[model samples]
Target: MITGEIKSQIDRIWDVIWSGGMSNPLEVVEQLTYLLFIKRLDDQQTTALERATLLDEPLVDNPFRLGKDELGRDYDDLRWSRLKNMHPEEAFDVVANRVFPYIREMRGDESTYAQHMKDARLTIPSASLLSRVIDLLDAVPMDNLDTKGDVYEYLLSEISSAGKNGQFRTPRHIIQLMVEMLAPEPGDTIVDPASGTCGFLVAATEYMRAHHADAINSGKWREHFHRQMFHGFDFDNTMLRIGSMNMLLHGVEQPDVRYRDSLAESNTGDADAYSMVLANPPFAGSLDYENTAKDLQRIVKTKKTELLFVALFLRLLKPGGRAAVIVPDGVLFGSSKAHKELRRTLVEDHKLDAVVKLPSGVFKPYAGVSTAILFFTKTNSGGTEKVWFYEVTADGMSLDDKRTPLLSDEKLGALAVLTDEEHGKNNLPDVLKRWQSRNSTEKDRERTDQSFCAPKADIAAQDYDLSLNRYKEIVHEEIEHRSPTEILDELDQLEKEIADGMAELRAMLLGGAE
Candidate 1:
């Protein structure tokens, strides 16, 4: 979690960007990400230099070469530490002319990060605004991975409104819940098909480091952690850039964060290629049949982006690969053939492990569409015996536009120490606990409970409808009411008492008059 002071600093930088004529929230964040990336390069170079000096060893590879560029400007001046001390005009000139191009030209061993920076542009409009933003960003503590990741996430949160293509950031707690439930292993290959800012991948990486620290430290696992374990795909260049930077700051050195429209292309080359998948793809968009991917259409013949994404998940996962992804509630019980076929595919064709229904207001102030998380495995044959269903009411935050935190910092996420009574206010921790025991205690739970399992036969009887309400029995409390005669008796008694009081009042008035 970012401190309030750090959040305020980020907000101030946002204000500067907006005042400088970059009113689009996405553009503001994109620009900030670029600057932060530049700053990170400088920080890395400085650390490398310090380590080399301490060991009295020469540097092996310097990202910052000590030389002038073809434009006759000193490359050393473009370093963040040196540029911050220059006059506003000189700072602006160097950044716009030198630093932007330098970063655009930077290449990693795999060149994924530099590939997305091909269109990098300096859009801060004025020298003063640029200078002020630099000062603000420089004050932020990006020395540690936790703080840096938090700061970047704080900045990403500013793009609260939905984008043109129905893209919006999934709530971090929601992402955490999915990642925790998935419990990514260090050796597992993970992918988020709609990797907006790579939140899912980042959360998975954090979970691995926290739980499987020893596995990550080994040479084999360490190599995977830095290079091949994480992959994300996004069509938007801006999102790709931001998502790539997000992974880098979180310490994934060479994540395959590249640009690809997951639903538009054939999956023949990469089908069944990943061990795990996690995503919350865009919902409710329609695509032309001719323009849609033929392979996805073959899996589920529909242009609905939601259904296509579900099919895409199946295609992307190898047999025995598991996935936890969010889908709109309509996918649960829609009357359309495509919807039914997809649900049937999960239940009868593969292992549909669980369906977690989220509250409608969870995506409030941007979308009020009810959604659910589908946990399933690609078995290429039926394995779903009993499907667990959990209805998540509160996720440690108010399900409103503001999404204010409902608990203190210490009592959040999987480690929340709330009592049973307090747990009612946040269902995340309970969800995790129950999920672990789904095969045992959850199997016998009644339909009226918050979470219960429904047999696959029952689901098939309903034509493969996965909506919790379809099978969840509501235990309506009986309301007792008074009989009409009893109510009349009480009214009659009150009326007689009122009349006696009236008579006594009249007698007293008459005696006084006499």
Candidate 2:
């Protein structure tokens, strides 16, 4: 099903170019969305017509009532038949103005209210582009379940294109890793405050499917799916709309994706609204400090994205609800008023589950900031029992010239070390060995000397700076057992090569001047 959908999507894209239209992939996708909605509405109307005919009744519930009239003011001048053969620009204009307006009216009906189609959200492209897109998308049967996912997936990918907005969308692979580490349960409500394209929610759903397939299939999952399993929020209306479709494409219809900035402190009422929250929030972004200061002061008391989101996540979760979030590395060690309060709250007030340091290039092609994964649980006891930290400098991937993900290697390494059960005083030698090697004594986990673990006692000594590097030791590579003469020879050759290069550059410059 996924394969066919992908093929159809490719075909649609090809047709747009063949029909004499120029558009980037992202622009083309925006146009595809407008058409897909119309086609789906048409399909719904057709189904209604069939059912009404069989039951000997009128199609009273057909909200769009697409075929009932010749045309409405909404469709510019293009109708289905007219659009198919017209010039690309003419067709596009008709669809953008005429068709979109009608679809907007139909979709906005209170009865059909949904996060994805909450009226028209697309920044409709030019008529020529819209025409080509419509022609392209029309090539596929938009109502086909398989094709729909493919088209939506394509759009989701396009949304991640450079300069669109925000960081490039979080990759699905990384999202899956976060969900697996957090291990959301059956009845647990999963939320992503900065959901962007809903990558985390989709991953959480997949996690549920794999771990609780039997429970999900018995229709028991409906309760969880509708009310518990997923919640997402974002400030960008476009992102919210895109996120809605992303969830729907993955079978999460009627998703609870609210359109609001989760990092803003003014929205505290909406915080503390979920159980499990996973997010890759908008990075390097700041909120209104003066306005949010009152609410924020209660948490970190400083207006920073990392601190605000931490407070937001804590407020959102029910007591004992877990969260795994990604934040800039500076948040882990930066000396700021908010940073201090953020650490105090996590290590002292909440249980710090684990801190996994990530390489700087994970967000390459968009954001180059080094990052860390903070896995924490809101505890009933109001104090941390134990905390684990992994200072992963190299996940088997070079953080140099080329930024490639070594998922298989890094994931396997992390899985081997991260135990699901408590690591405190376990008779488990393998887990103990891994932990001990990665960290010194448990006290080292909290100490201010190493890059990884230190106990509560050590943490208290540092006034509870929860920076992983404060405790985890940076182990230097072992020096090779080579003679001093051999090392000197190597350095001498390197120096000679540098001198030769300089001499050549000097000669070239002198010749050019002459």
Candidate 3:
């Protein structure tokens, strides 16, 4: 049930955001995040204290550490109870003074708020607004990580409307699909260079736990998972902070998510990089070559998402490292010089494993751009091998014909079908049926009939136009096959009907003349 309390609280929060002078939704979310984290921390400490006292634990080691004043009133450093005493605007100012200092100090030279602090003010709504928000948050239980995750996810979804700061967050289901396909092993180092809200990081963590539950529960998980495996980087400080908080909420302690413009050479050199890079890099944004060239390669490799990120990921990945990335459809078939060069590099220099073409409406609510997923491995020079291609015809559903929630559909599962002994031979008939129908040649020439297997020669011949639509020919079923006589009979019946209608019209005209 959509509880009234939750909806009302959400509305109030929205009202506050609109009422406040904050222009950016992401910025508004940032302010809310700061407040929420402080409140939740205090709540947890309070609960921890209660639990400890109930169990008769030692009083010397209080996790909360709430300070006390001379009048017997608790003067906890930054708890909501103490802040509640001040006016909302004043309270937010105080919070900014205390909490932000800690954050900036922790972030050192790389803090996003560091420069903004010069002119930063905590001006917000009135005390009443703050109090109501606090009351609303109080209703939420802060004991479990999943609960916190649910709240965070909702907030991200709410603020993910398009054309907001050039940020269109990737859908969670798509993130889940990538993580599941990659199958990040427990303790495997995972990184997202363009970590928007850390969706990939969170999904990767969940994927590991779900796949290797026993190992995760055995308590050695943290030792393996922490600084060793999970990593991320982004140019946006605001995004980095959100990503860090999100990783923390998802039980990832000390997430190494950082802020770095990866395309620049100097920034790339200064940054501590990663092994497996999974990212949907920002596209359509013009690159400042004068600045970015210090970190990014100067040679005009490609203008599209895949080429830019491919270069970056290749540089980021160690030898034999794998990369799965989301790219625009243009990268698959664009005839630009950079595009051809990048494709040649992938075929001749690296292992291009698979390409999955997603439906155009995948990002409906946020964006209507058609996209594709490219999975590849970083290797030395290699021959042209078979690359599996899957086209997702339906991407969930929508009631109002906008972006709808991601739902599981059996028909769309043909994209990730397995052929080898590892995934079992029996599990591939439906997919193979379509694949073979498209290409009947023993040499596997690229067929425009169905989504068929293509030979290297044919791909080279076509200049490597990898658009699935070009190859996956739609086969329309014959509608009620009829013999020549039956077709003639139907045409004769239709002719008689037309003749009778004409005769009635003529009769009416003659009556009028009479």
How far out, in Å, is residue 206 in model 2?
A: 1.5
RMSD of 2: 10.6
Better of 1 and 3 by lDDT: 1
Name the weakest run of 10 consecutive residues (lDDT summed) in model 3: 422-431
Note each model's CA RMSD in angstroms.
3.5, 10.6, 7.2
In model 3, the Cα lDDT at residue 455 comes to 51
lDDT of every model, 2 decimals: 0.83, 0.62, 0.61
Ranking by lDDT: 1, 2, 3
Poorest lDDT segment (10 consecutive residues) of candidate 1: 144-153
* lDDT tens digits by residue: candidate 1, 303-407: 899999999999999999999999999999998999999999988889999999999877665678899999999999889999999998887777776667788
lDDT of 1: 0.83
TM-score of each: 0.87, 0.65, 0.72
Estimate the TM-score for candidate 1. Answer: 0.87
Q: Which candidate leads the pack in TM-score? A: 1
Candidates 2 and 3 compared: the better one by lDDT is 2
Ranking by TM-score: 1, 3, 2
Residue 172 alpha-carbon offset, candidate 1, angstroms: 1.8
Encode model 2's per-residue lDDT on 132-185: one tens digit a residue.
556556667544233433444545544554334444565444565677677777
Error of 3 at 42 (Å): 4.7
